[model samples]
Target: MTVEIRVSRSPGERRVALLRDGVLAGYRVERPARPDGVGDTLRGRVVSRLPALAGGFVALPGGESGFLPESECEGRRLPPEGTILTLRVTRAAQSGKGLRISARVKQRPSGPLALLERGPDQALRWAAAHPAAPLVVDDPAELARLRAALGPRATGGAAFDDALESEADSLALPETPLPGGGRLIISPLPALTAVDVDSGGADPREANRQALPELTRQIVLRDLAGPILLDLAGLSLKARGALEPAIRSALVGDGLVQALGFGPLGLFEMKRARIHPPLHEVLADRPLARGLALLRLAAREAAAAPHRVLALSAPAPVLDAIRALPGALEEFAARAGRPLVLRDASLEEVSDA
Candidate 1:
């Protein structure tokens, strides 16, 4: 039952891993391009109201707009266009949708369209939720910040446990091996996520039962939201019905998830509230991720071989992205004590040559 939170910070990205009994139970990534404004408070101007949709779009800071549902207005009528109001961000923008905002704040601050209060960092927010769990942070500045935010509970050390790091990295893969020779194939589609339970020649019911824990863990770790369709390996109606309680029990900790039971098409249906985008969506920009990865690799190489000059090669677009990111190349050169050579390679993979 022991739980710990580990945070690793790098230029342009922050990774947080939740470990339960030394196992990676949950993982989250925060990047500058994809900001998860879950708890930010802002003053926004209503742009338009659509009675048909029962919501309106509010112009937010930085040229972004959010949808404020009528239900989130605390029973107040939708304000006319051009009315300024204090708002809180309920969910981050995801899947081509803008942020979901609510107008139910304790105090309404009148002002121009701007960010009023920045939300807690993801690590601090997680620490608040699991107050008892000790926070292990790698970066000195982040550790100091966490200590100021939550005294005594934050400590300095390596954030990623070796085994847990490997496990967390593998989360990007589509296939997950289950106990008893079975595996789960998780595919995130545009409309809904689909999970197929492969029994691997074992008893269907037993395999499905064994996959429940890992399945739920993946759901939480990946932050998979929206409609999820599960296709259990060959099972009878009675067997599927019998597994309902177990499925519900497995999803006990996540309040956002609701088991909707089986559909007419024999697929098990569940819905998780859409907040932050899922892991796949967060890593959707492959070139950007690759560029960041190359920078990290260069850093590691410099540490391992202090005297070896490093040259990073990648696609032209990837190199352009790296050069354009503020402080990205500068930080690497500062840490490595030598400028890195950048080369344009037509290959898809990034490498330190």
Candidate 2:
């Protein structure tokens, strides 16, 4: 029942992984973007309205567009295309998805709109809100940031080492080992995620009984949302009937809000509202986002690097993202009191920085 939060510097972003009893149950990648738009009020122009979708797209001042549901605009007049109005971001931008925006009315809002934190900050907030757990980070600077985010309750140090890094790498794999030699395979598609549970020849009921709690843990850990279909390996009608109650109890026990039931074809169906993008999506689809993340990591490493110059090697896309944020990158270098050398990809094989 022990929970551990490991914060590490990953290419172009800060990666936070949650381990329950040493098993990677959940993870998040935090990267800065053009104001993730969540919980922030901004002026935007109506780009287009889609009656079929029950919403329209609004182009924010920052040039990115978000979706405005008709429900949110019920009391307000529907502004025409190019009409400017202030709105708040209900959901952040993600892969092939725009922000979920809601209408706002503040005739001369006093100050800048506040933004909701995501990734590392969100993870810290979650850790602080939950049962006390050891928070581990690889960098002293990051540790300080965690302290600032969590206040006095935060207590941890630079505990991430080579061995833990390897453990993290293994834990990140799609296929994860379950207790009792069973395995869980998670496959994500563009529309939804599918989790296949293999009981490994054990009693289907018993194995599933043991696996449901861990499954819920994974769901929370991965920040998985929307539709999820769990394909448990074996189950008879009676077993399924028994499994349903167990699954419900597990989800409730974990304090997770997911509608659970069996589907038409005997597959276990689950649906949870999307609050944030999963770890893979943030790291894979958002290159520029990751680039900003890398810059942030560089700023942190700059302080500890033995030399004044910090060497960084990452994919071309990530480097491009860094270049896109020249001002931020320069500021990061200034704060670290070091110059950064972006390693050429040809000279060194590259992955995420």
* Top-TM-score structure, candidate number: 1
Pairs with backbone N, CA or C atoms under 3 Å apart (clashes), candidate 1: none
Show how many residue pairs clash in every candidate, following the order shown. Answer: 0, 4
lDDT by residue (tens digit), candidate 1, 1-353: 99999997665667899888987877898875446888899999999999999999999998999999998886757888998989999998887788999999975757788989888767877888798999998767677888898897989988876777778778889999999999999999988999999999999999999999989999999999999999888998777878888888988878889999988878889999998889999888788778887787787788789999999978898898788777777767776788889988865344433
For residues 170-231, write the lDDT of model 2, one tens digit per residue: 44468877888888888877788898888888776677777887788777766677788888
Alpha-carbon local distance difference test for all models: 0.86, 0.67
TM-score of each predicted structure versus truth: 0.92, 0.74
Model 1: CA > 4 A from native: 306-308, 337-339, 347-353
The stretch of ten residues in a row with the least summed lDDT in candidate 2 is: 110-119
Query: How many angstroms is residue 292 displaced in model 1 relative to the true structure, after the best TM-score fit?
Result: 1.7
Best by lDDT: 1
Error (Å) of candidate 1 at residue 89 is 0.9
